[model samples]
Target: MATKLLTFVIFLAGVLPAADAAIDIGKVLGEHREFSLFSSLLSSTGVARATNSREAVTVLAPNNTAVVAALRGVPRGADTRALLSDVLSLHVILEYIDADKLELLAEGRSGDGTRVTTLLQANGKAQGRYAGFVHISVGEEEYDRITFTSGAIGSPWNATFEKAIAQLPPSVSVLQVSGFIFPPGVIPPQPRARQTSMPPAPSPAPGPMAHPPRQPLLPAPAPAPPRPTPATPNLTNTPPPSGNVIPIPIPSVDGGMNATLPSAAGHRVASSWGVAGLLFGLVVCLIWSL
Candidate 1:
């Protein structure tokens, strides 16, 4: 009877929420050091306060070796702190993402499709790995050298969840399937801008043919009055004046001088030819004289 009662109690405990159930994420993660880097980042970013009371969040985490590997060559300084803030902001989601959702999401995705704005208004991209079968949208900018990053899947939790989280580094940014844990008002991906082909320009209209100007009607010329037949003068010829000498004055040569100048081109050609012939003759004569 005691054993039966114990089994009933165990069943009840298993079914209850952490307030009603036994284990919460903080309690579970308390034991894992692989997640220490993520924890530190959460604290640094003050994200721990947000997650403190939240439940059922499945974190895709990178282990200590993974964290060290990521941070190996990173300078430990103020800059590193700023980088850490962004890295931590990237990893944690407001809610949980379960396994089934992850697989379905992975199968359907390719490339980084969109940036998911979380409840914290943190922005991250969705990336597809595993030949588009697994989606990873991690945005952890490392100030250090990336040495050993956990793969998409890892061992240890090797049995179930480890392969998924371990394969990836312990980052707050991780791949989760759809519908695991939803923060309210998770905005849908933005629509891509539509490419609109411009409409072609309209053709010009045919123009009307131009008409030639009409010829002006001119007034008929007044009929010329019949010219009076030139009167045939009576043939009484006046006798030539006797001994009248009519002298014709010669045209003055100075006033009537009409001289034509040679064309410039013609003069130039004639001058060049003359010079050339003279030169040739001089040469010939010198030869003959010698």
Candidate 2:
């Protein structure tokens, strides 16, 4: 019985180290000082605790500088915690991917890339077929260069894989990327490129036309008093003249003449008086001769 118990104790001791060999994400990240900020974020958001339950996962951990840059524009508040939680979850892919697997994928696909789902998808926050997925592809010029792209709306962001931070084959792998992988709606869409050209100067609004001053109303000059009609002379009451007298004309108001002239009877009377005078002269001359 003593020999059998010693053999069982040795077997138990042999099994304990293998159990303790599982990767601790927090410890893996904590070993690298450059990832200190990312590690703290993972702790604060409780993502580090949840990582152990997953069978396999690849953490694309951004360096301190990259994390700082990503947080610069994010506003602070209660929503920030939730936002950061979502963002950190997006960084975690639900599969084991290391440099070797990435090279194999790149070679197999000819740079077309492979899509991998993330923790965000597992949380059910991502709904569509491609939502909360990371795109892994090789650089066009350099076949060895691997790139990770986030499927952000309108503006997708890309991060180049710098190096493998830590790797435990077929279980967990933490990769150092050039920048943070921002999920759709995480970063504010760039304020639609500030209308730089200065909005076309608003067309000058047309102004009202100026009117001329009105003159005071005047009673039209009383029609000029009708010119007084000239009075007409009464010819019926005037008596006819007995001698050969000619009346001089007088200018009337209308620039015309009004008068009487000598007639044939006056001429005949003059002729008769001249003949009688001549006969008396002849008779007196004969008496003187006797």
Which candidate number would show the highest lDDT if scored against the true structure?
Answer: 2
Local distance difference test, each candidate: 0.43, 0.76
- My TM-score estimates for the predictions, one after another, are 0.33, 0.56
| C-alpha RMSD of candidate 1 | 29.4
What tens digits encode model 1's per-residue C-alpha lDDT throughout 129-226? Answer: 21111123322342121111112232011101234432121222233211112122222222344558878889989899899988869967888788
Off by over 4 Å in 1: 1-26, 53-56, 109-290
Candidate 1: C-alpha lDDT = 0.43
How well is each residue in 1-290 modelled by candidate 2, as lDDT tens digits?
Answer: 99999999999998877553665788888789999999998998877877767888999999999887766655566767777777788789899988888777555565477778888878887645566888777766666688777654343546888988888878889999988776665653222334457767888999998888887698567788789899675478664564755554444788687744456554665577679889999999999999
Residue 64 alpha-carbon offset, candidate 1, angstroms = 0.9
* Local lDDT at 252 for model 2: 72
Q: Which residue runs of candidate 2 sit more than 4 Å off their true CA positions?
A: 1-17, 20-22, 108-110, 140-144, 151-155, 188-290
lDDT of 2 at 157: 45
| Weakest ten-residue segment in model 1 by summed lDDT | 150-159
Q: In candidate 1, residue 93 scores what lDDT?
A: 46
Worst 10 residues of 2 by lDDT: 187-196
